[model samples]
Target: MDPSRSEFAIHEAAREGKAGVVDSLLNANPKLATQKDDDDRLPIHWAIANNHLDITSTLINTRNFDPDTPDGSGWTPLMIASSLKDNQGEQTVDLLLQKDVEVNAQSFNGQTALHFASSKDNLDIARKLIEHKASTRLKDKRGQLPLHRAAAVGSMPIVKLLLENKSPLNASDVDGMTALHHATSEGHGDAAVALLKAGAETDKRDMDGRLAIDTAPDAKVRKFILQSAEREGIEIVTS
Candidate 1:
């Protein structure tokens, strides 16, 4: 989306990682830090999304800055930071965590920061959120847990972490699919095996009346999961 004119200077600056320009803009008008862009996002949102910790910290220090402020989509800075590419979003995540914010705050879709982090396979951010006592069992609007998001993306470490943190091993979503279902359907053989090893029930069926293996995108995925289960001594009754 194009900037809505000169009012977006600080937003653009933060988005571009122009620390100096952001500082200058903030110095000129401290309120710019809290000003929402056409996208309904504050400068802090862009800074955190771009992984500019310096700019993020600067914006945080501004007067009356709401650390848990939601954007147009009701996503907090933590959610954006969690979804960043690569593994460089930790600094921003840490910075936001240090502030007075809701660690388990949900978005418009009831997605927590953990959901974003897990969906992107951001292990570090997920760990940080977990350390901060982020809930492993908070289901999204779709009734999907963070574990489901992690499994769908084949984020094994996150899946393990959530499981270790006592996220329900077989919680079904609104669609009646568990994390195992998500892993198998997405062809994440390793994830499916991990869930199975963690004791995900194989007999559970989805709303479509398909077992987890039956939801696999193709026969190859189903075969790999079945073979892996066999190697792990986990019997999967496909008959």
Candidate 2:
């Protein structure tokens, strides 16, 4: 180890997009390229998080780096890239995919890279993950898919994209609550409408045997769900 270099000097270089410095460190100590930060994030993890596409490519392709290594949060480099809110759009995501990063790798919550990408409303990231074989059907530990997260957060574009991916619109969570259940309960009427249009089973019941309308906290939400349900030729049972 270089006396002046901290344990995370490689990480710092990757995060700052100092490709040359990172190359030097990786060359001097190839193992340092894979060393985890305080958060258990390797230098590649920092590269993805910071959207250093060139550095990420160098680490992944040239170094034959491990892209599946998880961070302290059980998040992989792909997951970190998906969660990135910066980085000139999908440049980082695309680079990871080119290196064969596993898009469906799960975090501690069983949330895939797609989940984080959708939650961020990064259409480019989401699309890239999907294109790279991210499983749209895989749910988190709670049984909530990317669509459920999008619906709950009122991300219409993500909801639409997930629906287009043919995600099971009526797939339920651990509570047996479907994406519609979340959208209605969260008062996301527009999301509910989009879901219904995408063939989400509106009458699907939760573990409590309650429909989406039953959990709807407001009359407007209930009314919208009811309207969409009627249009979808499904019965809405509110208790």
Candidate 3:
């Protein structure tokens, strides 16, 4: 009955994937659904964070449930769901989405569900979020867009998807690095090529005045970017 005892009974049940127990506990004390545990997370936050779809569904149906409620770091359940990497994650996203969850809610750092999906390279979730009207252009605290995260992680499909959704092709982050810069510097050749073909400015210079190609970590990636740029008729200009 102590709030400081690590977690609530319902939280333990949810984290451990005990669907039946979670249901019973919620029935006993529906307020448990909204009660913050030791981690400042509601029971549903744990359920969805652990990819327990059934528990997430149960928690969502509880009275006064707010799909937009955030955890300690301002990470909403939808953001957490987007970061998950399985079919259950999809189910969880769908479950919360049915409640008209705020797909665009940002965390403490201004990262939305789209940002998380892009960062995790979850194309399906990213697509789903986009369908729900999540913004592809929401920037994080560092001014890095979802497109930037996708490029940095070498997620070519995600990069393409965000671009299709109108992510600014040449948007720069706090470091003045564009998505192309991230892709090239991280050594993602295919992604770099994709960015270039999509009309990414080859001469975009970062804070250090380094071009996207100049930021490439090696001769191979640099060579690929140059070759791909040449093929696409995108002139590669140095800073």
Worst 10 residues of 1 by lDDT: 1-10
Model 2 lDDT at residue 184: 83
lDDT by residue (1-239, candidate 1, tens digit) is 53423768889889999898887777777888888988899999988887788888888888898889999999998888888877678888887788867989999999999999999999988899999989999999999999999999999999999999989999999999999999999989999999999999999998989899888898888889988899989999684
Where model 1 places Cα greater than 4 Å from the true spot, the runs are 1-5
Q: Which prediction has more favorable lDDT, 1 or 2?
A: 1
For model 3 the TM-score comes to 0.94
On a 0 to 100 scale, what is the lDDT of residue 180 in model 3? 91
lDDT of 3 by residue, 72-101 (tens): 999999999999864348888888889999
**Which prediction has the highest lDDT against the true structure?**
1
Cα-based RMSD of candidate 2: 2.9
Candidates sorted by TM-score, descending order?
3, 1, 2
Q: Give the CA lDDT, 0 to 100, for residue 197 in model 2.
A: 72
Q: What is the lDDT of residue 159 in candidate 3?
A: 94
The alpha-carbon root-mean-square deviation between model 3 and the true structure, to one decimal in Å, is 2.2
- What lDDT does the true structure give each of the candidates? 0.89, 0.81, 0.88
**TM-scores for all predictions:** 0.94, 0.84, 0.94
